[model samples]
Target: MDVFDRMQNGYLYRPEDPNLGISNTEQLKKQRLFNQTADHTILKRMFAAFGDGSQLRPPLFSVWGGQFVEVGRDVKIGPGLTLVDDAPIIIGDRVQIGASVTISVAGHPVDPTLRRRRLAFNLAVHLDDDCVIGDQVIILPGVTIGKGAIIEAGSIVTKDIPAHVVAAGNPCRVIQQVQVEKVEPKMAKSEFEKMRDGSLYLPEDPAILAEQQIHMKLQYQYNNLEPGDPKQAAMLKKMFADCGEECYIEPPLHANWGGFHTHLGDRVYANFNLTLVDDADIYIGDDTMIGPNVNISTAGHPIWPAYRLKKYQHNQQVHIGKNCWLGANVTVLPGVTIGDNTVVGAGSVVTKDLPANVVAVGNPCRVLREINDHDRQYYYKDRRVDLDE
Candidate 1:
């Protein structure tokens, strides 16, 4: 079987030893080659500010600054994937991400008061090792995926996913357990040499690279102002009145925005192609970043069905706290609160409140674990910078 198949189905040649598969040198070489190519593609997207080349498989598309985030090794990011990390997004090793998937780690509130003022909030998303995410899924803010979990395609994850389980549906749930195996293979010396020497080509242009950087900075600035800055604050209020607090309006390169409500706190970042439907309040905290194509909705339809047809709608409140990271394409629904130092995984749909210092991921996002020193050390080491210092 091909390497991709092996990675998906596991390395087992027989049913009896499902966890065991080919361990030859040739197979290892092939995997390495695939990884190198994939890494190159991910780097080309450049969606995060703290991204590492050793962590991703390539041909990835980052809508914003995806190059800054940190990703683990053997992680597969499929085509048309979006990671929005206006905050930090931390991914673990051997994570399988499917095609057209989105991991979002930031969001805003829907409250009219906050929205009118152009205030935005953020939550973090985190994913552990050996998690498999399905295609076209949306992960919301403040979610964490446990080890060896599976998320079905087109599912909306807003809660936490336990380890060794399968979750699916619109608001993803725990369905079953997952079985994993290891495999190895041998490769030709020539192929191995090519992979090692890096004979691959990725789109490279200084202008585009510069633009991406500039965009990230501008977006950061858009979310960083305090209410005291009158000129900027007045502009922010006007912008919020015009476009809501969490709207994702692309700014022109090298241009200063007069008035719009977009503000991120210290150490906050997001992934690529993040579409913020900020018709309301959106607020984020310090040291938090979002993933690619993450859609944060501050506005929701009426549950009564009669109000659904209305052209205008009310807003909800969305809040994310400090030192949190969100995954790719995560969606945060209206009126949710995410506490400090949390992590959310990819393709999750957040529909509720998440407490401080925990890992939560899935539909209707739940608390997975309390944040400890280990979690802090893994994601925050050498990454946070104090501007005031």
Candidate 2:
């Protein structure tokens, strides 16, 4: 295999390998020229893929120059950007990277002897679309910041952060989700505030309906488009408060608030006729798959007929954790927090909270059983999971 492949695969390779020859000469030359000139045209010429309207200032540093880096459209990269681009560094569209951000993909071997020989490996770092990296943030190897995520200044990102969250600290953790402004405890509450806080409120409040109607217009556009339309993603990003990467909701999505109160995580797939009563909030975590005809609601009304006639409604947030599978015709009720890696059977109504790693079915959704070793060995009842058939 080639030396480049060896480095990228996390197999250590020596920089002084004779067969590789002088690889850094051209990169170094371009790095010097770009930094001195600050001409964005040179940036376009340097990287693997530098999209249109992306700009970067001077004082950029990279060992392999910008050869392995990919910058998407309309990205604003500030000055003093440092890159150890031995592997790929992919920056997605509309990404705003602050000054003095260091992104490193190269790492030395832990073994002393290997370190003495200057053996190194590479792992790619990715910053997804619309993410903002604050000044002096250090992103380590193999870390992917998800779509619309914001990294606080002076933080060190050591792990992959989930989409649409605000993360901070030395080893960054998500301090808060990034959909709406936090309501102050002592502040005067509006009708919208009442709805968000789970108190009885009116959806017909003029201000609230105005925002919902805007989303409804966008949703109408989204639902009527061609099935495989490219516009769906951008529309979802605009409509939802926190819409992550690789999330797909098959059209004919019915949402009461038009997804104004939803936080969708990455790799989430929803089949046709998925309904979201997202009045307060609905957080569907990453890698969760929803079967056809599932209804997840966050809004409810009073049991009393008098309050119902007056259009009194209350909302409770629903939180579904990562890697869950909701079968067809399942209904997840308000205020329920379903844990990670759980499977909800078809035609089940989840009225209460369900724990992780269990199979739940039937009305009011009681736990059928915990996911066991036997289940992994068998794909179905009495059917073995055979690799070779």
Candidate 3:
């Protein structure tokens, strides 16, 4: 099948197949299930370090290597959740997740030609604890969600979410505030059991957490080393040894010395080919992701004569809130704050602050729609998942 068919069928097609453009229905279904199960296993093992009490409800799907995926204690996850982590994705205790929620924590360069040149870009995502994410929500990269935030079903989280607020809709807005009470141990156990058995529900694990951490450490080591010098390979190796649980950076490739700075929270992730340009500081909140080829950069040069002469001094700060997603090829400009739980569209140029709980797309990026119960109801009315309390 072609890329579109593969996406629609939720499976990867064989490259050598003569009829690669045709969808293999049976294979697609089987591959979808396999992918979900594999993602669930990876998530289980990765979070296994978090403690035995941590939980994950299955049917969670992801790409290779489980980049930037993190789970919290006593958490619940639902089906059809796609988390693309090239960064970090962190979760807090007692969070509830809904189905078909897309959390991507990575982005690529804005210039198409430069992107083809494998130039690094800068973007990341974060999500705090004690949040409730509704069904069919799309979270973009470089966003953060504060503690005790509630994202209404089908809402798109595009910006930062302040603590203890209820945000929803496309380009999600702060519609109201929610009163949150801690779940007692006994109650927590009961809820966990219900979710594990597929009765109660929750959102998927944020996939950016682990990936971001790995990317940050790799960039830090490379920044301190010499460029194009194989002698410096040992320095990079030693740095990885010292990283411990903070991150995992695979082998370096050509042009791996792009300066990128990333600051991560307690839990983070950075998937394959995650690039950074540390010419500026890129701060990512706890539990975020940086997906494959998900580039986070602060290396843009100014076009004006005076500023251009100075080569656009790299001192800007790109701040990403907790619990967000930066989709594939999503480009974020310098000095931008992606609000918590926000979703940015692929191939988008983010030039300003995106408020929390919204979905945005297109060049120059306009708010496409707000994720809400009405939208959720329209899309998933027939689904068995229960989003409303």
**Which candidate comes out best when scored by TM-score?**
2
* Model 3 CA lDDT for position 226: 51
For residues 225-249, could you state the per-residue lDDT of candidate 3 as single tens digits?
Answer: 5545564444433433222134333
Task: Give each model's whole-structure lDDT.
Answer: 0.56, 0.86, 0.56
TM-score to true structure, per model:
0.35, 0.52, 0.37
**After TM-score superposition, what is the CA distance of residue 380 in candidate 2 from its true location, in Å?**
1.8
Clash count of each predicted structure = 125, 0, 99
Tens digits of per-residue lDDT for model 2 on 1-389? 88978976777798678754478678789889987777788887789989998877667888878888999998887656889888899998888887668999978878999999888888899999888887678999989999888888679999999888889999999999877343111112345667889998767854466556767988888899997899989988988889999999999989987787899999999999999998889999999999999999988999999999989899999999999999999999999999999999999999999999999999989999999999888988999998874
Candidates, ranked, lDDT: 2, 1, 3
Whichever of 2 and 3 has more TM-score, that candidate is 2
Q: lDDT tens digits, residues 1-389, model 1?
A: 74323322323122122242333234334334543464465353443322343433333444234533567776666545566544456777767776556787656556776565544444567888777787667888778988877787678899888887878987889987666442111111121122113222111222223323433564466556553444543343344323323323232111112222234554455554666554345677766777777777665554666555443245565677877777887888877788887788788898888888788888867777787766444556676543452
Candidate 1 all-Cα RMSD: 26.9
TM-score computed on alpha carbons, candidate 1: 0.35
TM-score of 2: 0.52
